[model samples]
Target: MLKKLYGKLEISINALESWMKERKNLAGLLVGIVILGGLIGCAIWLNQPVEGEVPTSASQMAYEKASVTAVLEDGAVPDYEDAEGRRVGTQELEIRILTGTHKGEIMSLTNYMSALFNVDVEKGDQIIVRIMTDEDGSYYASLFNYNRGIVLGVFVLIFFILLAVLGGKKGLGALLGLLFTLASIWFVLIPCLIRGIPAIAATVGIVAVTAAGALVLLNGFSLKTLCSVLGCVIGVVAAGGIAALVGNITPMNGFNMPEAENLLLYGADKGMKISGLLVCGVLISALGAVMDVALGIASSIWELHEQNPSLPGRALFRSGMHIGRDAMGTMANTLILAFAGSSLNMLILVQTYDIPFIQLINTDYICIEIIQSVAGALGILLTVPIVAFISARLMARGKRVS
Candidate 1:
């Protein structure tokens, strides 16, 4: 009787333990859902357009979709070699409006084609048309561009399908995290900058928020996620600081950027802080890579400690550093090569013109590219040690306490 009672007690205890574990997991899932839902609601609220913000001229114009019904005329213009030796011509087409206020209206429009801005279309091709209203209530329509929205939509769908199929539950978590990051940028960061918030501070705040949220969503609430979040924020801020210091020393700033003039003209009245835009850009660009390095090191260190709870903090630290060093080479090269690839056209131009090395290096465009690449790489370098040290200390302490 005593032995049978003991066995029954053991089974009951095991069942209780299993139940507690399931309850804990369910609680975590509930918390995650709440946080994610709140974030989405906030994003939607912040994305609403402000009333009376549209200019008068822009309010009088509309874009509508149309399909080419017939090609009424197509002829090349003579002596138009100015288009880089490419054919310059014009096309007259009859189009039927497919959407907006003029849906089902048939009209004849002139479509211009050139080497730089060509939209050669055939019959049955869908395109975008810009319509303008005059004071007398008359309207004019012109060919704007080809309608590629369906193609883009389909491509994005394919990407989501592949991500879900390959990654399973983890992939779904990653997809949610990605959407959160984009929402924070578009709904929070850009709006704050446009509303005259200090660019550097706003960008850094967004970087931290997005990093923390993404890591939490990806790994759930854990010491590893916390360490990675801290490491990523520090590394990205360090990169931005380095870029800002270089910009000040070289007397280069957003004003030297190609789009600065246009931004000034459009955003001056809106109180935009253009000076810090360059540093803001660097912080955002470096964030993904920094987060990757930090999480990788932290996760590795945590796994090491889990496998051998007897390992000392120093041993875990050393193991993390070794892993980080292996990652550094490829990550640094990745940043530099990305920058170079984006500027391939400019590099080709310099080579074609046989630009002197001194002149080439001194150009603002070239200097900006170099600073971006180097600063981002330096951030990754710093993240390695930060993540290693933090992960080691935390994992070791957890083991000791347990």
Candidate 2:
């Protein structure tokens, strides 16, 4: 009985040793995650309270407040309106400040006949208000945007907890992936962009770093991972080239991005290919899905070969194509739908104008988005065949050697 017990003990010890060897990197990842979580906690603490008072020379500022009552167009309406209409035709809000040095301030404001949006503002509603200083030396309300920091914080904390408790060591690897992605963006990609590196180049650099980091963490030096990496790089180059070509021919002006337009106006104060930037934008945006498709196809083929080591390379290639076809079909639609969802507002605008099919598709935004979607689709399309072909040869090398 003692010998049997000892034998069991030895087996358990060996298993534990083997597990530790595999998970040693995971321990380091957890320590890093804890450190990162602490840093994020510090950042959240710093953003709280959001500057006690809006500084002077402030173009606009908003704050949350409550009010006693509100009125609209010849009626003393209830503080809260169940079916609030538009802000128009001399509608006014009657409000009382709930907090701050301006507590108990009353305001009768014009609603300006604007349709009340999804998040409505009304008297007694805890709402944000833009501070406005009139020529008469008095401050008043202008506009408001919602404050959602607290909600966002709660969501983020819950997600982190989910990762830690549910995933344990694997969660730690995920956290490392997050850090890796962020660092690649901030250190490598952003710096490249700052140096005026071509956006495609910067983005490809970032994606390469991302692919390497993820593959190493998950698959180490395995042939599957290496093949996937090579396949992803090739796909990205092709995708970027396609995007650039399509974007150059498209009518979308360089100043299309609201934020980018403003930044360009500030940065150059003059001649910059706001349009060339658009080309880069399209390329960078689609590169991610391209990499994902490459990895998926390559890894699938590699795993198939691992499972059936007796299979020849040609057979494995065929099997990978089968997998790739199924993946490519859904993935192409998914990519297109993802882009469509983002441009739903643009589509709505086009519908509002009753634009003809030719005109609608010809629109710069539509054209630009098409280029992005097509580039991504083409890249994904190409990656499957490439990864399969490469992984097949590499996997076959093993069989030949054996």
TM-score of every candidate relative to the true structure = 0.89, 0.66
> Per-residue error at 219 for model 1, in Å?
1.8
User: Model 1, 105-166: lDDT tens per residue?
Assistant: 99999988888788888899999999877889888789999999999999998998898889
- Displacement of the residue 9 alpha carbon in candidate 2, Å: 23
Instruction: List residue ranges in candidate 1 displaced over 4 A.
Output: 1-60, 76-87, 400-402
- In candidate 2, position 259 carries an lDDT of 62
| Backbone clashes counted, model 2 | 8
The TM-score between candidate 2 and the true structure equals 0.66
Candidate 2, residues 279-377, lDDT tens digits: the string is: 556555655676567777877877777778889889989998898898787777877999999989887987898989988776666776777787878
Residue 43 local lDDT, model 2: 41
TM-score, candidate number 1: 0.89
* lDDT (C-alpha) at residue 393 in model 1: 88
